[model samples]
Target: MTRTELQTLPERAVELLGGEPDDTTLRRYLHGLAGVDAVGLGQRAADLGTRSIKTTSKAWALDRIIELIDLTTLEGADTPGKVRSLVAKALNPDASDPTCPRVAAVCVYGDMVPHAVAALGAAHGDPDDGGVSVAAVATAFPSGRASLAIKLADTAEAVAAGADEIDMVIDRGAFLAGRYGQVFDQIAQVKQACRRADGSYASLKVILETGELTTYDNVKRASWLAILAGGDFIKTSTGKVQPAATLPVTLLMLEVVRDWHAATGEKIGVKPAGGIRTSKDAIKYLVTVAETVGEEWLQPHLFRFGASSLLNDVLLQRQKLRTGHYTGADYVTID
Candidate 1:
């Protein structure tokens, strides 16, 4: 579609949910989506994975992967020092190569937003403008088992602290229990809370934690649900789950985003967090995104990799391409 036809929503606009957000409406819409053919989906993903790239294309893919990384540090022991180091790495992912592109954002816990923002300083802003964004995980990330009041407070605190993006986890319990409306309301409320004082809202990435969702059909439904609720992105995991971000699950989510764009003339982002630690694996995802959605979704705003070690591997690959020789594991910084 042309740029004029793309129905981009204002950051603070009402949700894309056209109908009443009641449970009945949610159930019907969700269940009404075409069922996923597991065998076919998996086979497609595997088939795409086998499509190799030329040396020049591999070099391009390596850099593109770097730009898509959400240089993340989320842990109980996380501190200002750690965040600063992460920001440093983000600013210059490859210290030896000044031409190396910056990462899309530095993802941290909500409490660390201030530190991340401070460290990013003048470099903190829109990814499109060559500035790295600060993404804070809120809404009781990973577990998402908190009261609505606390969750809103969490989001508000992050936005107040200069977070450019908010990665919120959906109430998977509610979703799995058939309370789709509750999940929808929570996402919508979180999106509202992401609004800043000036009225612009922080980008909201709704994490589905697909590993726990149990079925590909549920992943597709969750993707649509997140988009309808006004999520700027639909993420695959919190990076805490065991089966985080498999190729098939991400492919399913991308298909949903593509269908949504086709029907509504709007675009939504997708992220596959965790377990994607190699350039080869990441390229498979890139191939899938290109074939399923379109090459336009490759931008940082439209796609992301929620990972830590993934960067190290990409860096190593990049170095190898530059020098035409193998790089040892010690070549890249430890995450």
Candidate 2:
């Protein structure tokens, strides 16, 4: 969709809120949101995490987890060689084992999109084989503190360089300061910038940095705000924060997506990024998704894990499942 198509968003927001919402009106809507029961939410997540999956189910889950991974590398020291190596790992996660599935996408910084695109084409012979997508983090990335022009330029450059997906960060400062209109307008503008020259737009993943939001209520408000503002996926964090992507936080976002779909019939994706390192940890997230949202969300398009080391752990577990024994770290290539 184009910016012209979304010009009526303010009207839509007014309708959604039952009237035109000024800043005070927006705050009232946000404050009127139901309070989260932290204790109950944590208990539910913990209980769901304990539901055991046997060998067969676990094997199935391992493959699904592989497909759901973004296979990310967003470090300051990122080089083209590092991106090429990561792209190779993304294309063939387990080289010795062809049965293992490729990851959903290769995530990198905006500047690295061209490198990743070239590497993917060289490795796979066709960059658009649907084997993997190149995701670029834009809009000032982990910190959305830059001007809108720079942010839009960041997104447009990544798109022009052939990033299939754009992971843009929300201005937490604006949101926290109660500038809801500013936050919503920035997201809408970035969504517009995601539109490629070919008329097909890249999928936009809005990172809320939930850890910085400071409350489950803010998380809920941010989820709704992003979805309503045209985010294809509402992400947990940028992974730079200390407490990125916790289970309780992810569970709250899942509930937001579920309820949003029920109300609007629009199915927005969810990504739980950062600090998720083990296959066991990934499986608990899967369980929460299955029980909270439903089986329909098990696909890669609807769910994703935004982690670098998590891929290796998942591959190792898949190898163990295939060979009936644990494999050493040397077996699976590091990301």
Candidate 3:
């Protein structure tokens, strides 16, 4: 929660697990996690959605949303030209205004990693250093339906091409079929695959794809499983599925990160991707984060929004905040 007091983490995970994460022990630790109260969880998220941060604070939240965004473009038709355009937008969301903060990263398909890095050039590095990062979706991306060899290769290729982050979808089928160990093992191996030749590793954001998780309990278990398996961030979706991201699911994952910090002092990140289209929607999530995990968890490394069109809306609202009047949708570039 209080990330201001948090230490800089290793380039890779330094063993947050207890004992070997074999099937039996992994299952025992996951199942030992407290069950979610569906009604209470839903109600709590609803309540946070109503808290207001108007005027100046709202302006601050809008820009913070921009900084936290992964500025994503994960379409099947993604090309090098389109990735360069996305990289430009990440570098300067509002070309008219020099003060607009750049996004945290330009998330693209694995094949687009090279194009993104090349487009970014000197402007690509750690987001904390005022440089945008390039996050590539790997491990078979939205489906997680590939062989482990394919998945590892997918991850390795992205890192090899200079991806700073890897967003991997978990095997929902394996988890749903009660193969917890398999899911855990795949994530662990993917984590290993994220290692670059220089020995530094890409940050792994495990996409739980909660739409298929089917229950709050499963989301909770998956959150802990991802963290224990060394996910730097527990993301809600691949944005290809229905019901991609929701406040309640994000809240539940935030609770896991919060509790995990209390237990191990490890600050795991939580990302709620998809369907978060407007500054209004993004502000609700910001409020949720500040309340659940403490305001300090609101950072480029600790939180991120996987989005494409969300940036268009935030840019519009930011114009309204500065000019005291709304701009036409045409003023904001559509992703």
Candidate 4:
């Protein structure tokens, strides 16, 4: 349905539903949403994001998200060969030579984008290559702690060096202290800096470190704030915090995405990063989206996992099903 059609929905379902969604009701709702009235319900939840009203399901969606994981890390280990090997391992954990389920991306620090770019460029030589794109963690990376001048410079550098996408962390201190303008302004500038070499822009994924925020309401608030401030995607955690991207936090974020899309007539993506580590975990996340947002969000564009070890498990599981027995650990590489 169009955004205009979403105009009459209640402004805040959390308040209407009385005290927000609890775990049991939320899980039942998310899990059972598929064949029921979720389109209208999900649309309502999605609309809340437009109203800047925070609404979240009671059960944390992390467990479900863990099942649809994206194994990721930003380090490149200091060399091109290492970079290529990492990508290779993620692509072909069983040494299948040239095929594997596409990983979300091979996340790398800004300086390493050149190495990743060169490697990916060569891999693209073969049309069927499963090479992952280079996703640079920019805007001063995990901390979001830097001068705007330096942050923008860092973002530009990552893109200039050929980052396929850019993940910029919002200034947590600013956002936490209610300095939404500063945080939003920084994200906007960084997005601008991430323009493609051809003058287009790399997709912008904003990281909202949920652990730093004191409550679920704040997490929801941060989610909309990022979107309104121009984030193409809203992500959980920087993997530097104690609670880094949990099920509850992810559920809250998903609700934010759903609500935002319902209200603005704009589609935004969701990425749950940090700590996901298995195929079962990844699939559950897929289920959550399918249940919470519907099948339209099943594609990589709207949904993804940010993980590193999770791919190895996904490969192992696929291999196990393809063959008839368990594969030895040596054939797969998580490190």
Candidate 5:
């Protein structure tokens, strides 16, 4: 509960993961392995790993960020082509994706979930289709800004309609007014509502709308509170605000994820939404993960980006590499 207690792994660290090896065993194995450090790894990640003199190489930070993109930025039924484009970009963030890691997920407003799901489903049928998931923004996003009854119904609809995951924004007005219990209770209830009688439910990501919270301390508190209240992922914004997601805010949240994972042995995810538009920006996020939460959180289930525009640039860079011609223009414009 205290800082020192949180910094240390839980008493049942090994037991936290049922039937898994203890932390001591993990430490000993890494200590004995070559080029491995049980303790020094996270402490040593470099910024961009030294900027390339060639100016042609993608920043190591960007490469990592590309790997974690959720690529949602999608809306409307007519925008499936845009989704397809984003997928292409993600698949080829560099050189036609000769060896690029996949994007974390593809996010969309809830109404578009059926379309997004159908697109991915079609892709799955093709042997060459690259797989990415659909994350739906639910519970009256950009405004948590609504009644709890309406919010719950909204979340239930999204999950039932084929949303692999749901990103719900919290009511910042309540949080800022020091109504912590109200904020926390709403999140917990919404998370429960997302579940079905079949015991299946979309992953619930609670968006704190960090910009609205307006303070680093508040961000940290919100992150902790969200994790405590059963948020599978704590996101930064709705991408509708002027100062949606930012590096500093993300850094604070990432630290919270690290601390939460250490204390409760629960790996709550982090998502930075809004204003991220380039592969370079994306990479910085990867650096944050490697440095703050270690390499394991880099997976799609644990990390995500909510940008629609960033995907095109990532794809353009890839196309340039493959055809030896870098003339492709921007593929998406913000709506």
Candidate 6:
């Protein structure tokens, strides 16, 4: 599709969802989503995890996984210097090998968006040149305990600062308390706030923090809620919570996106963030995507890994594949 046609996707999805649903309608839509069978879901994910990938296939997986990495750093000690370094790393993950592909994006806290944008511009010369995007975590990230006003302001600040993407955490307390409409409204408002002063809007990734949601059924519900509320992507975690992204959680999310596409004909993205630290683990998630959703979802636009260490591991594996010998940690740059 052309750029004009692609830009109209969000408008079409919003129209299909009825332009801001009411509480009753939202609750009905939430209730209508089918529940997932925990046992069956776990069994299938485990079986997929066992699939063997080697040699040439492993090389292909490494390249694709490199492109899908968000290259994240969400710490209390983040600084402009740190963000610049991260941006440089994202632009050239493996400087020794020029053929190495750049990462999908560099993710940081909201206040660091501009630093990332500036750094990326210095590296690539144009902010929209499309070498790599800058993603900011907003909406009271990780905890999601703040008020909606503060959350929306946070989102706006990130987008106004030139973030290409916004990763917002959902209000888990409201969701677990059975306030589905409240959660839906919050996501919708955040989605709206992503619109910049110019007519353009950053892509929105709604993080469910699945570890705290406590059940597969809740993950399914949260997935549908985020998609219906205009989230371009549904993410698995904040990486702060203990049990961040798991095969089963990500698998179920893939199923949710697959089903949503089947119903609406609008494709949504899936990001399995947090705790996915190895190239092997990253490949398993890719395998899950290919087997469960189809190879179409394997691209960065449709899939992502919200990870920092994952890039290093993928680079190390790439080097090993190139030389037929494993390289030491000193070979790759430390984040």
Which candidate has the highest TM-score of all?
1
Q: Tell me each candidate's RMSD, in Å, in order.
A: 4.4, 4.5, 4.8, 11.4, 10.6, 4.7
Better of 1 and 5 by TM-score: 1
Provide the TM-score for each candidate, comma-separated: 0.92, 0.90, 0.91, 0.73, 0.72, 0.89
lDDT of 2 by residue, 195-296 (tens): 889787788899999989998889999998887677889999999996899999999999999987777666778999999999888888888888888867
| lDDT leaderboard ranking | 1, 3, 2, 6, 5, 4
Q: Write the per-residue lDDT of candidate 3 for residues 205-314, one digit (tens) a residue.
A: 99999999999999999998888777889999999988989999999999999998997777888889989898777888988898898888888999999999999989
Q: Which residue pairs collide in model 2, if any?
A: none
Encode model 5's per-residue lDDT on 1-335: one tens digit a residue: 22122222223433433322333443342233233231343333333222221222343334445666777664445376766665555444555356665666667777766766666654422111346666778778777778999999988887877776888888888777766667766887788777766775567889988877776667776776676566788899988876898776777778778877786667878888889887656655666666678767766678887777776666656556456774423211111
lDDT for each of the candidates? 0.86, 0.84, 0.86, 0.62, 0.65, 0.83
- The list of candidate 6 runs beyond 4 A from truth reads 1-20, 52-56, 122-130, 326-335
Q: Tens digit of lDDT per residue, candidate 1, span 1-335? A: 32221134433122444467778878887898789999999999998776644332666788889999999999999999999999999999988999899999999999999999899899998887789999999998879999999999999999999998999999998999989889888988898898889877888999999999999999988888887777989999999997999999999988888888887777888999989999878888888888788778888989999999999988888888788885443222211
What is candidate 1's CA lDDT for residue 274? 89
Arrange candidates by TM-score, descending: 1, 3, 2, 6, 4, 5
Q: After TM-score superposition, what is the CA distance of residue 164 in candidate 1 from its true location, in Å?
A: 0.7
Which digits, one per residue and each the tens of the lDDT, describe model 6 over residues 200-263? 7788999999999998888998998888777889999999997899999999999988887877
- Residue 209 CA error for candidate 6 (Å)? 0.6
Please list all clashing residue pairs in model 6, or write none if there are none: none
lDDT of 4 by residue, 1-335 (tens): 32121212223323322333343332333333222233554554344322210132211222223233344556535566777776665444556734444454677788877866676665522112434566778877788888999988888888888776788999888766666657756776777787666666677889998888776666776776676556778899778786876655666677777876775556777888877776544554555566566657755556778877776666656666456674433221111
Provide the clash count, candidate 6. Answer: 0
Instruction: List candidate 3 segments past 4 Å from native.
Output: 1-19, 53-56, 326-335
TM-score of 3: 0.91
Model 3 poorest ten-residue lDDT run = 3-12
Error of 1 at 76 (Å): 0.4
Least well predicted 10-residue stretch by lDDT in candidate 1: 3-12
